[model samples]
Target chain A: MPTKTVAGTTVEVNDEGFFTDPSQWTEEMAPELAEAEGIDTLTDPHWTVIRFMRQEFEEKGTGPTVRALGKTSGVTVKELYQLFPKGPAKIAARVAGIPKPRGCI
Target chain B: MTHRIVILGAGTGGTLAANRLRREYSTDEATITVVDQDDVHVYQPGLLFVPFALARPDDIVRPRQDQLHDHIEYIQSPIEAVEPDADRVHLTDGTVLDFDVLVVATGAALLPEETEGLTGPGWGEKVHTFYTLEGATALRDSLAAFDGGRLVINVVDMPIKCPVAPLEFAFLADWFFTDRKMRDSVDITYVTPLDAAFTKPVAAKRLGGMLAERGIDLVTEFNTGEVDGEGGRLVSYDEREVPFDVAVVIPLHGGQPYVGRSPGLGDALDFVPTDPHTLQSQSRPNVFALGDATNVPASKAGSVTHFEGDVLVENVSRFIAGEELDASYDGHANCFIETGFGKAMLIDFNYDTEPLPGHFPSKVGMPLLKESRANHLGKLMFQWFYWHALLPGRDIPGIGPDMPTTGKRSPESESP
Candidate 1:
């Protein structure tokens, strides 16, 4: 395990840069994390998915899968891909300060 | 003095060509020599089944020498360089072999190192690929330990062997998890460099729709620049990143190293440029290439190579007779896409045709571009056909180098 300093704060991360512990994540740290992951600006639509993923992770203990988000988040698959091209659930979970969601196909 | 014929690879393409050429020329007329680095002949299409344990790695491989004709001499040595001008090939052992006709069938190799961070930390631990034996075997373990999470199958670029394999993996993974009653726990995504799920627009739509129907997310137009294996993320130059618990990748592919070692023999990517129709190398008239070794626009599939072998052998016969080469090959490529649930979809197409929905070979034949139990069995039966009929160069009836358009439905007609 390695620790990466982002936004003047250090957090435990795995070799793939995924957060080792979700407890240390902060709402303000997402933009910097997103920037490092390739999203330049967090638009309203981007935040909508990010916030939804974070809320879902808090409530359910796991980020929503792409199918669940596409159906419930009011974001179509095409729109979600446009919003987060790396993949909706994977990137949104990262920006939401959650561990990379398990069971991503 | 015997006429020497040298084929540079022992994969499906080279093995079929060696057998076909031997049948065409008598033992006294021509002595065929096949050179390769090793004796293990992998059933590449079978590699897709390994991660799911549908097929074992050991079952998919055999000795390369066992596949060739007895008359064809097998040289177990690495090719250091190829000198087409002198009709000679230099092996790593410093043995120079001469040939009257040379066939470059030394198919492509996966180059994961070409992409930055792919083979970095957590490579074999987190990021895995099924394109190789070790990669596939490792992924089986990774998949077993995977309780649930995102499993991404990423195709680094197109022109990969059996272009539909990644999609098949996604489909099969769906079945595997569902069988374990854990399909709900896994998230499957197919990420590719193409804008659509597949290359051809019509086929892409159908395939893309299949992904949607199966609950598999489709991420297209993704040109991966790096794989943060340690972080389990794929970073693109465009600044998009795909993260996963386990990544099954079909890494970037390029022609064999020896192809580049030879001057004026291959294109920039080491793929020998061949006339799309004649399958004869542009570098030399007597030189020919097929399969993944050629810089042709056709799909780099075993079926494509099988069709090319038919026309190539004829052209080789015509060349020796000083006659005009036959231009019969029309990029015929057929593929069976396994769609899980004991069903598969077959597609028959060529250079000018996209895969159309209809019965293939005949009007009442097995359904094409549509899944059926028969198609699944056909796919399973192909392994038997590959070793018995295909590699032996025996022609199966109704199948040829030209794509038959008789029973196929045109997109416009089908819609209207």
Candidate 2:
């Protein structure tokens, strides 16, 4: 495990830089995390997706897949790609401060 | 008064659980009943070898009831819905089965129709799947007729039964075409929604390397949104397209339809929300689930169901006896990866660990994560074991419910 500073707060993360303790995340860290992944600004749409991801993780104990997020997160699949870019499921999960979606290897 | 234990679905999990329960409780103690829509049990794993003409459809088919203990009752009826509140299961034929405890083992169902244009123009012709018996049989004919072109194998989504089967199909296809003397003319590609060849890091790297070594192109993170079989194209949600002459698609899989009808019993995908360790349904204490039917984050493979059988039987007994349920199941899952040319690889791991290298069970046992002829022989021998020992709930010698860590060499233990 490794710790990193984001928004003046230290948080634990895994080898892939995903948050180990989601409780350490705050709304203030969202912009910095998003920027670290190449997103410069946090729009309302981004918050909507991020909030939905956190809620889903809290309920299901895992983050939603791209398919599930697209279907239930009030966001279209195309929009998710534009919002998160490259890999919506993985990238958004990191920024949302939830564990990676385990689709069962 | 005898306790009534009703098990839904007579597939691998239900059949073995029923058998193991029978041995645990005598006929005077409990009456075990297993139900499924039909008696046909098509040794699901063997379906993987069908497209390569290695297995005949007829050879794998068997009556599901034949696998159960004679003392257990087997019913043939479609499940209507589970009234968990009433402690009963409703059958489509207007029959209600009451039980002291219920096991929801109805496995995953293939939903190819869910994808747009998948079953449209060239479905059974140019585009086929080997996940089902009919699909595999159809694919066998299609592969035989295929001379040369791009043959793409696409996995529509994840959490599928035997997640490694598609990779196995790709490896076998390479060997199949080469054996037919048309390897040069055929270009093979594997497309998956995952960012890697597999979910786990160690195994994914090895499998990806094998795909590259075999000259099979690997396309990752391509979430297939539609299958335009008529146009011979697979379109991803990201607006990327992978064209193919023959497409073998592993369609999205979900739990049995009846799971959806039964409220408070399943997740959005209809898979029972089960406690991963205890194998008990999160919905109700008396209702339990295993196999591909449960949303347990473990690989949906038969070996998982087999391992889960031991813990499930114990917990069911404990629940019936008004004792504490055993939280012993560690999500142990293993698979024999068929890596072409009479050689295969074995991977064993549990919830806490990913598949690692070294031998299994013990250091002297078959090699793990590395291809070997012995592992391939073990793979072939498992078929016999599945029917004779596994389905009957006989404890396999040296193999136990929990994953053994003795022989496995963790990355930290390896010499730099």
Candidate 3:
């Protein structure tokens, strides 16, 4: 596992830079992770999605998919793309310190 | 009192479980009943080949009850709802069947209506799907009439049954057009909501490379918001557009509507909240689920259902006998991926392991993660096996529920 410094804190991450140990993630790490993924700032809407993702991951053992994030994360699917840009489910999970939402291959 | 087992769906999981359970218990000791909405049990795997005209639609379907053991009771009635608390099932025909154990195997249903304009102007004309018998047949006609232009294969969302089927359809389409001597006039593009061609990393990389090599364009992370079939464009949630001359779209899938009707039965998607390892429903002690009906994070493929049958049958029996349930199911799943022409690739994996490059069953058995004519032959031969060995619950020689690792090579081993 590779370790990276985000927000002055060293955290373990996978090959794709998603947190290997989600417990190492702090609320302060969200802004830096967001910036790493090309987002300029951590706005209130971004935090709402990030917090929802974290809570969902804690409860379900996995982050919600883009559809689930849009439906239940209090963010519209259009707004999700506006907030996260390219991949909402993936980028939001990264900032929230959760594993990538997987589909069976 | 005789132990009553009511297995719903009568599809792959339900039929196999019924047959296996029947063999375990005599009719005097237990009564096995299987229910489904209809008698036609279409060989779902064959649906993948239907659009390509490789398999006839009529040849792939059979009477559902014919597959079950004679001792097992078969009911043809649409399920109304499952009263889990009362251990009763209400059918649309007004029959309420009581059971000591209930197995929910009612598989996923395709919902094209969920997306705006998907079922609009050119639904059966320009935009088509191969996920259903009707869709596959309609797509066959559409593809036959299609001579040229941009042909896009779009997957609407994830967790769809046979996740690799859409990819198979694309590969076969390349072969189909080439066979017709019209390969040049056609441009093939594969669109998906995922970040890659597939979910697993190794398989994705391998499959993605194959797509590029075949000159099939891959558009990833595209969350389709609407299908403008009349205008011939797919509008994403982000407003990115992928224009198509004809679109083969795999629509969003959810569990049967009856699952949602039953309170405390299913998740947001209507897939039963199941214990992934145990194959038991989280809602009630006597309730269990398998196959596409459960939100178990496994591929919704027939092989997964076949592999799961062994564990699910055992656990169902255990629950009835007042014994400990077996939690041995390790999310084992395998699929034969058709890669056009006369070759196909095989992949075998389980929970905690991604599809790797190696042989399956044993080191010398068959090539894994690489296209081979032998795997293609295996794919062709599986239809016969599906009817004879698989649905009857007979044990396949040398293959068990657990994923075999003997022939597999790990990434770490290769790196060192």
Give model 3's share of reference contacts: 0.48
lDDT of 2 at B82: 97
- Per-prediction DockQ comes to 0.02, 0.53, 0.48
TM-score, chain B, predicted structure 2: 0.99
lDDT string, candidate 2, B315-399, tens digits: 9999999999999999899899999999999999989999999998898998999999998999988889899999999988877
Candidate 1 vs candidate 3: which has greater TM-score? Answer: 3
User: Which lDDT value does model 1 have at A18?
Assistant: 70
Q: Write the per-residue lDDT of candidate 2 for residues A1-105, one digit (tens) a residue.
A: 799999998899999989989999888899999999999998998999999999999997889887778768999877898899877888898998887777565
Predicted complex 1: DockQ: 0.02
Tell me which residue pairs clash in candidate 2.
none
Over B116-162, each residue of candidate 3 has an lDDT whose tens digit, in order, gives: 89999999999999888999999999999997999999999988999
Residue B329 of model 3, lDDT score: 93
Task: Show how many residue pairs clash in every candidate, following the order shown.
Answer: 20, 0, 0
Q: Which TM-score value belongs to model 2?
A: 0.94
Model 1 Cα displacement at B144 (Å)? 1.3
In candidate 2, which residue ranges exceed 4 Å CA deviation?
Answer: A1-17, A28-45, A76-79
Cα lDDT listed for each candidate:
0.86, 0.92, 0.91
Q: Candidate 2, after superposition: displacement of residue B340 in Å?
A: 1.5
Docking class of 3: acceptable
